[model samples]
Target: MKPERARSLQWLLVRRLILLQAGMLLFFIVLLIVVLSVVKPRLMIDNEAAVTAVTGAVDRDKDGKLIVHDTDELTQFRAEHPKVWYIIHDTTGQTARVGMAPPDYDRDLGSLLSSVDHASIGFAGKRDGKEMRPEAFVQKVDTKAGPVQVVTSTFHSRSDSEGFDISITAIVDMARKPDGTADWPRVLPGLLASLGIVLLPIILAMGVTTLVTTPAVVRRSLTGLIGTANQAAHIDFDTRAMQLPVKNVPQEVVPLVNAFNQALSRLAQGIDSHNRFLTDAAHELRTPIAILRTRAELLTDEPETLRLRQDIERLSHLAQQLLDHQSLDRPNEHRRVVDLAEFAGRVAADLAPLAIEAGYDFAFEPPDGKVEVEVNALQIEQLLANIVRNAIEHGGGKGTITVLVDRAGGLEVHDEGPGIPVEEHKNVFEPFYRVHPHSHGAGLGLNLARQIAQLHGGSIAILNGPWQGARVRVHLPLHRQTA
Candidate 1:
């Protein structure tokens, strides 16, 4: 069984699913930003500003050829964009010059410029079927400064001499920021604004829908099984008529439930057969036992005939005890307010003659007023009679046997013979457990009495008596009337 504080499976699954979906969405959002920044470096690069800065720093040489001279303006421009690198090639003079560039940038820029020149298109029309306009685009590339955005604008400058043209190309470098952390405040609002109006509501709706319906769905799925178990709990096996409903029950549980019903059916059949056998056997033997007793009475009034009569009576009493034990197994037929003190006096009166004939003294001490209790009268009578009989038999048939009813609705039968041995106190209440094997009485009397006491929601206990005797106490509840 799970602990009380543990979460159920349905909620655990729903929480995990929602988190997984949200994580995937956030992952893709970061991935898309990285991809866009790399493909179009201008998204993070300010190319127009760098180009104007570079052109303003350019000057004319002695031959009137455009030359990029070292100036404070170029130094300040380099200070502002520390990662920017650039190169300008003069095809007319067959001269090349580098601008405010890193040492690693100077080495790799030549090959890069060569590639840019071949692919670059000038302002002039097609030459050898190739467009001559300058190649102007933005891209991200790896350099000594790490992955930086590069915006290159390539174009031809108009010259005074024919065929003497200068090619100007400017390169600016801006390092790419780490994913998810770069300009997040600015990017997040735009990104969320595009999706927030719709996507957030969609996700929330899905999560709320799952949370609201998950418990109900789980309860609905188990409803049939729960109903079947409750019905089984209240079923009385004696009726043996009810079966668990298979319809609407989960298929996986159907086989086990049906098997349980079948077991109960088999049990009911067995109990019915056993009871029928006990009833038939008791009926068959009762007539012969009565006939024997009558025949013994008809014989001459001698010791042998009297002994025979006593034996028949013992046998008859044993049969009755057996039947009484059997009745305790069935549900009681009626319930009423029984005056326990009056009831104990009546049972003691009926058994007093037997005690006297067996050389024992029998007495009853009932309370002055009625001590009423709600119980089945027949079962209560049987309980009292068995306790009295046990006292008479165990008292060696020569000592005082007393039945007392307390105002608390407790009935106690005690004997002034050899009290039951302390070791045998618990065992003596078990069926067929005799403290003395030679005793003529069947050992089922105490067990039957205990069962009857329990049926009425009471208890019976064997305790040491007040004065050198064993005491059997039956404690039951009393019924009271309100004014």
Candidate 2:
């Protein structure tokens, strides 16, 4: 697979995985909140009933009077502990006695009274009060005298009646404790119990769902990965990307996978075409090299043989350049960090004598400091040689070829040549594309350089240079040193 396409696929997969994890987490949290919210009221009602049952049993005796066997004893007990209040009502639901003024009943006495019934022993009711709503409950009793009801009120130690309300209605009214005063610590245990009850089913459902859906999810993921691999395996080099059918994929990843496959298909075709072109070009160059070698061997010791030798040498050089270019085109070549300034200096130095022989000046101006990048050193050398040679050959031979390296890991080669036409700028980087028909070298120079730059996560571009010269700039990322 092409590196760019592979990277894109990996990125898409990572993004999709993140979104999936987030969605699952959010779904679980919302579900947990909903379960807790729904179960809270029922738990509160159950706890209220339990509290009423326990308190009612303590307030009454077998005879069922507010003062059972010992009235005076009970009163003395009540005086000592005035927080306890009780009332007994008839079966007709009238207030026979008052406990602690039913906390708040002046505004909605009708609603509070209407709710009382034989089955209302543990029912909660609310009444309007001056400051806040007061809540209450009713408890039933069966005494030898008759059926009765008991009510209680919460004591406020900070109020005027020693923080108590001593009215008869207050004495027999149902109690509503102040905020944060009720047995909230008890509610924690209840909440834990409720959570246990609630989570038991959720856990079971999660397990069951995992058991049931996990295989399907895995199957689907495997199917998609397998299908993608299969499609990539069968991809044809000559064709554009085949649009893979992507129906029924997990909604999160469908678009990304589809785009990845499309990109891969395009990349595969590009690399395939490049390989084929390299092969065909190599085959075509072999015949000329062979003929030149044969002709050079035949004219040995003759005066014209020297010229033939030179021609053969030039042909050999071109062939070697072609082979080098082909090798650089392959994507699987190993890469390592190279100092661009140093590499360019060496290349320019090596070619300086050749440039002088050809009546062209060559200069190398490396950056003051080292500029390191990741690339295949030989390929980068070949790239520099091609561009510099092209500059010498086409930039009106006598002009200076200037090689400059910058601290940003950019390399620029400039020469006093007629700038490339804007229209042919893109075409110049295509293999075997040349601007001038009378150009000396083969047209693979820029193409090979661009390929090398791309392999190193860099790029090369041609633009107008200062003083009407052609400038070729190559930019590469800086390399990091590990400790």
Candidate 3:
């Protein structure tokens, strides 16, 4: 089965935060509009705003007469509010009236300008079947030209146009009923435009902020978990003492890490128990196998007796290989520097008799110079013995077995047997894996050799030889190191 595609935790977290922020902002905008719609909305002008608009438009004509000129604010106001009434009265007693109003306000503006500086001018009216009074802002201001009185009034649906907020004008204008009929086509567009004006910049700012900050926050928050995952990648039975650290981990993930640590502890305990059982069994079997070999030797030289002795000997060899393989995992106290060329020559000389007994010629070739290495003497001796035994047992029982050493800290054993198939090269080193399933050898030899070689910081591999045979090479990393 193929694995699922991996999703980035940081990317997922950032998307969630951005979506959460967007949801909140939209909710706030709707809530704001709802609250405003429920309140008593007004779009009235204040005395200060009224005076400033009026003063800017006040100027003298060519004949030196005070007049009111149309400015941008006044032009927009008049265009949207045709029913509005405004009267600009100057110090020269010339009054300019722009829109319709009750006769009382027009008459009072010119004659009562001296007495009234500010007043709420209005008339009695009925709205929503209730009695009400309209309101207009009247104020007098000093300008560059002279003093002028500005009376400004606006009409929407009611007279309660208090100076609380100004956006109410958009709502009123959208449904403006000057002919007692609402302008239905403009309502939706006007509402949408008002909302856009209020929300566009907020959306833009929040989008920028979310993009810039979310990934960094998520990555920093998960630093401890990432580190723990890195440590988990290299875990094995050899590193049973290793533990994952929880420093800077998030509070929510601490329990998960604790559970993982507890599980690892249980696994390490089981592995240790299994290894101890194997070591104990191998040691207990050695003495009985030795006794069995002695008794079997007493009756050998007959055909059936010879077969029995061979079986007993194979069992004894298997038991000893088990002991040797387990011993490689034990702590070493005899590691020292030895000349590999001289060392390989001595071990090969001792194994030559076995080669000759198997009907094969044996030879040892030493390097040109001293090829020294630091290793446990007993372990390397076992590793070399295993490789030579494998060659003698399977070297077609003919041809030559050659051991060669080089100055580069490499030792090779070449035999005139059919070379290992290319596909089985790597699998050959796995424990208990044999090319022929029923072979006499128990198959622990090469695997034990591999383990011992690795314990000394070296590696072993099968290479193609010139004689169409197996060339087994072992490379120790350094020739010699200071003790």
The best candidate in terms of TM-score: 3
Q: Which digits, one per residue and each the tens of the lDDT, describe model 2 over residues 237-300?
A: 3234466556645567777877877797768778768777876887788788888788778766
Which segments of candidate 2 are over 4 A away from where they belong? 1-318
Off by over 4 Å in 1: 1-250, 480-483
Error of 2 at 385 (Å): 1.0
TM-score of each: 0.55, 0.43, 0.70
Question: What is candidate 2's CA lDDT for residue 413?
Answer: 90
Better of 1 and 2 by lDDT: 1
- Ranked by TM-score, the better of candidates 1 and 2 is 1
TM-score winner between 2 and 3, please give it: 3
Please report, in order, the local distance difference test score of every candidate based on alpha carbons.
Answer: 0.70, 0.64, 0.78
Residue 335 shift from truth in candidate 1, angstroms: 0.9
How does residue 446 of candidate 3 score in lDDT? 88
Score candidate 2 by lDDT. 0.64
Clashing pairs in 1: 121-132, 121-133, 121-134, 122-132, 122-133
- Among these predictions, the greatest lDDT belongs to 3
